[model samples]
Target: MAFTPPKETYTGKVYTLEIGVPPDTVRFGGENVLPLHGFEGIVPSRPVIAYEIQDIPPDDWPDTVKKPFKDVSDDPVSWAKFCRDALKARAIALRLIGTHPDRENRSPEDAAKTVRDILSAIDVPLIILGSNHTEKDASVLIAAAEAAKDKNCIIGKAQEANYKTVAAAAMANNHKLIAMSELDINLSKQLNILITQMGFDKERIITDPMCSALGYGIEYTYSVMERIRLAALLQNDATMQQPMLGDIGMYVWKAKETQARPEDVPPWGSLEERGIAWEAVTAIALIIAGAELLVMRHPKAIEAVEKVVDELI
Candidate 1:
């Protein structure tokens, strides 16, 4: 007799989310098994990775990551097109970092204009992100949501402080919302409940339990994400069934491993290879932890993660 592998099944499935308009949309989640555990149950879609761009130049990004977009980074539209056409990016995430009060202090109107311009320039799905300033994001995301109305973009990052207003904006404009919380499973579920309480359909929301780099508390982040996935599947918790987001680039690029110069940290190897590998490893870890959508920088890093996803699925 042949030996057989034991398999486990689940009672719940993640909500499948579609972003962008028809003919160009991208979908993820809707899996009844844990990540890459398709042998046990249905796993309908592969993870989606979106290249991260900013409305303003990435002046603060370390040289290693910034070198790729040097020529087109000066303008958001040009930068977005480069990602789509040159890098073959399936989706794009535009962070309005310049709109932050501490940065260029660009107004909601300016952010809206940037959204319109980028939308016109690329056909791929766009994820509009605020600078993570809770107070300012409420206003900025509202304007950005309206600007991308009917385009079926994903507008985000409604936190506890501004979920009501931001959720309302995304609902009214017909865009998906990203509900982010600190690295706690309860907080993650609570935020999802709060957003749905406002009448925003829970299926349209993406839960971001937040993200951390490889050496910087990543184990904690992974545990929180894995527990969330288990609740969604094993416990059949509706509130925890939404797909997860790993905002990889922003967190990984800032880590000391990615930014430290080889000369300064003699044992760390080449700066460029170190940064790319750091990002790829962080992204792969999060994918295995149950992230269905990712926002990443570094073309080489994205390529490496894509290869890994292919082999896993």
Candidate 2:
């Protein structure tokens, strides 16, 4: 006798979003089942990973995470082009770390110039990020959105404090928005709803439910992302259906496990290997937890996650 395999049927679907223009666009989401649950339902596109670059040199990043791009990190345009040309990055995440009030305090105009330069240097979709300063982001992203106008970029990180301003800028410039919240399903859903309430199209929004490194509240982020995906697939929750973003490198490279020297933490083994594994593990876990888009640093880590995604899908 032959036995039948049990499969879960999903009642809802996630939206597919496209970024960049023809011949260079990338897409994700549009699945009717959970991540890689091919037997359960339809899975349209594989998850995408965007290599992370910065408008200024990543001075605060540990050497292990900084070595790969040491040659091109000095200029945002060179950095972005290297990711696209040499690294063969499908997407590039350009972070305006220099604009932070505590950092270089770069003017909005300077940010805009950087955005334009990067946009011209690469053809892949650009994920424009601010320095995580809410007040500063409100202004910086406006300039960024305008600079990348008609380029089909993703401008983001519209949190609760400044969602209105940021969402309006994204909407006005016709770019996708990233709605971020602390690692809480309820908060993530609320922020998405709020962004939509302000007349931003829900389909154009990406959700960032915050990111934590391995061994550092990562399980909490995992649980929240799982709940969000379940809500989207099982309960048919519209607000939770946006493709999730795992901003991997920032959190992973900063963790002690990734930065500690083998001499200082002898049991941890090679610091370089530990750092890459830490980032790759965190990224893979988030993907399993339902992330459809990932922003990561370190080419080896991104390559490993891409292999995992290939095997899963």
Give the range of the ten consecutive residues with the poorest summed lDDT in model 1: 117-126
At residue 226, what lDDT does model 2 achieve?
92
Best by lDDT: 1
User: Stretches of candidate 2 above 4 Å error?
Assistant: none
**In model 2, where is the ten-residue run with the lowest total lDDT?**
117-126
Alpha carbon lDDT of each predicted model: 0.94, 0.91
Task: Show model 1 residue runs off by greater than 4 Å.
Answer: none
lDDT of 1 by residue, 147-254 (tens): 999998899899999999899999999999999999989989999998898899999999999999999988988999999999999999999999999999999988
Give the clashing residue pairs of candidate 1, or none.
Answer: none
Give the TM-score comparing model 1 with the true structure, all chains together: 0.99
TM-score of 2: 0.98
Residues 253-285, candidate 2, lDDT per residue (tens digit)?
Answer: 889998889999899899999899999999999
